[model samples]
Target: MEQSSKKSALSEKDGVNQPQSLSNSSVEVIKQMRRKQPSAQELIDGILAKDKVALSRAITLVESTNPEHLEKANTIIQACLPHANKSIRIGITGVPGVGKSTFIEAFGKHITSLGRKVAVLAVDPSSTISHGSILGDKTRMEELVKDENAFIRPSASGETLGGVARKTRETIILCEACGFDTIIIETVGVGQSETAVHSMVDFFLLLKISGAGDELQGIKRGIMEMADAIVINKADGDNIAKAKLAKTEFNRALHLFPAKQSGWIPTAATCSSYTKEGIDTVWKTISDYFELVKTNHYFEEKRQNQNQFWMMETINEQLKSNFYNHPEIIKLLEENKKAVQNDEISPFAAAINLLGKYFKS
Candidate 1:
């Protein structure tokens, strides 16, 4: 009887241990799901669930280039596709001292006061030497950064160009799904190269300094041609007259460049970001823009174009990654570089030969 009792006790002990082991395994699975980027369905469900943290993580995943995360990011994008078209994307750019940050701070606060949510993503060009970002937007937009209705993300140039972050398109999708109606993309104004932001935004606001007539002489005409609305910042006190003068010059210059896009004529105005003067007018102008374009079917067309642009960009990134991933190609490229340096082959010819070798299989 004693032996039988001992056997029964052992069986019960094993049974108890089994549940604990299974529970630990289950907890691990849940943790892993949390650590990974949520699937497209999970992203949509999380948005519906009002899970802001999950939404943010999903955006990060979409921006990541990790070979493992690509499929997950694509699925998340597809899942959130239905809920993604509910927001307005605004691209704002200006030269370094045009007060883009300060203006956004004032402008963003005003938008939130009307009970609308704002998300500002700054795209600062990465320094080639440091291979890191400057991330200056957070320091500049103090009030917007603190506002509950505002989400300000600093620039992430990250070995990319076009003054916008590589993942900004994906980030915008997630933000829109989370019910953010206003999305602002701030770019480092690198002259004509910054036009990449224009391809993605609903409105392109080019901020210029009042005294830029002198500076404009050196600036290219292509940048001015792309502006939908030009705002002269620092339009107060000593700069008022200069700002007005710039407004005239820009208006005259705009007439010379022809209209950009369909049914769009560039408009110029002046604003004092320090006092928040003319900020409301600026917003009203943008609002009027939506009214003008919505009726003409231009708004929808623009969104479709932007989506196409994102797809192309994603494919290009994938191709670049694949090209660099080939060990033989990399070795051949290094060898070809020395040959070119010794004048054995031209750069163009060397590139073609390497590409042919890479694709020969």
Candidate 2:
């Protein structure tokens, strides 16, 4: 009887443990079901409805390099193109330690308060050694991050010369499609990125600060010429006078540059992100510039030119990728590199040999 009782207790314990194991497995199955991918149409519908989750997912799809994801991303972009071009795209750039995040938070909040949906595509610097990104923009712009009407995405620069992600233009399209009235593309602020940002944006705003050397030294002369407006940030407390002086200097220097194609002169403004002063003036400046450009039809013309530029850029990128990725080229590249270093072969001859092998293969 004692033996039978012990056997019954063991069986009951096994039966109890079986359901617990099954329960744990059932929870995992539920999680997998929750993570199942959404279809393209669903993503489109959700994005059009201004669903932030869907918008983020759509941007991720656009950023993906996977072949299948790229195809789907292209389809999504094609579907969304008709709905885009409604937003005013702005590019904001400045050197490090110029308070770009604080200014953006203030600027973004001010815009959102006026019933405008804002989207920030902040490009973060990727480490050259690890190729990984800090992606800390969201943390820096806490107010904007918490705002219901704002969408902020931080992308790795991936060592692109322009300090922008390769997919920034596509990301802009997706953001516009999601009904954001204001789309801000924040570059990594390494100075070379201004031209790339200017090419895509309707207006380029250069954020500067007083006491940062000559205002021109803070930004390259080429970048200054490209700015639609120069905003001197941190213009509060004792720095107000210095900010005004910087603004004066910037204005005088801008007068020396040739006129813009839009025929509207670039202006300067002073703003204190801490005090939230001059933020509205900055917005008004952008609005007035857009109004003037739209009246002259330059806005449309610029976007058309951007499209052509992107097409050419894509073609060039593809050709380079194909050339460098060829198996024959890869096999010869290392050997030729060593030969060149040792003076066994001229660099020109090595190049020709590689090209010959590539073409034959």
Candidate 3:
């Protein structure tokens, strides 16, 4: 480098040029990585070829809130439609304290051991204040997370199940197209999350632990009716006897619920994620359900109905998003909310006022 020592303050000679921080080729590569999103056809082809990286990227696009990503994600879903619906979608839900992650890992590893590819879509609850989620399913399921035959994706349970469930449903399609034969959706088990998951899955499993006195007392009637199998998890050590008792109680409670349209009688089973005991029984139970449903043709019928439900849900989600995002409505919503909270206006009136302006504008 050369410098001008004898130069006027305002007329200093230009210093010799320094090398670029990055090469032109390196810059081009970085730009391509940042700016070039894979085409829908390219993502579809990659998914069909069972590429995990492509599957993850495609799922990310589906979950993205960006308008452009939404368009591409829809296109990719349409393309993968032909290959989807071939896998059994199972919904597993339990209360917050239940060992859902551990049970899922054990169950998933067992499924993969049987030479089947498994994909887990675990939904973590988001905090109301911060809207941030723990997203720790991958961390919790270390062994299953590392398995070559297993794929785990953790998604945040947003304000509602509408958008997140839709994304999860689409992710299922992508995973199926990528050759995953079994898809498991693990819900955060809050509010209506289980119901949303139940609508999409073929077999619904309600996981439980032996505690809190009567097991039947803790279960919701709707969940019991929806559940194809109620499996009591953590049936290891001193919990074995309690688990068996819970299983018996659950079986009796299951008998009280009316017969299902699928003509399948839900049963209560026990499984130990620690000892791997009765894990196979859970699979056998799931297999038995699929066999019966397929034989009775309820499997295809349910899929058709689920597709219709998905359409309605998508409509609801889009309308909700549009209403909340309206500039005119956005200005008035907080005013109405504060008015309602202060008893200046009834919630119904506030809602009507907001809805009226939203629709009018």
- On lDDT, the candidate that comes out on top is 2
Better of 1 and 2 by TM-score: 2
Number of backbone collisions per candidate, in order? 1, 0, 0
lDDT of 3 by residue, 8-75 (tens): 87886779999998799998899999798788898899999999989999999998999999999999
Clashing pairs in 1: 40-76
**lDDT to native, each model:** 0.80, 0.90, 0.89
Q: Model 1: what TM-score?
A: 0.84
The residue-by-residue lDDT of candidate 2 on 15-110, one tens digit each, is: 433334358878989999779988889989988898889989988888887879988898888898999999999999998889999999999999
**Once superposed on the true structure, which residue ranges of model 2 sit more than 4 Å away at CA?**
1-35, 214-220
lDDT (Cα) of model 2: 0.90
True-vs-predicted CA distance for residue 112, candidate 3, Å:
1.1
Residue 358 of model 3 has an lDDT of 82
Highest TM-score model number: 2
Better of 1 and 2 by lDDT: 2
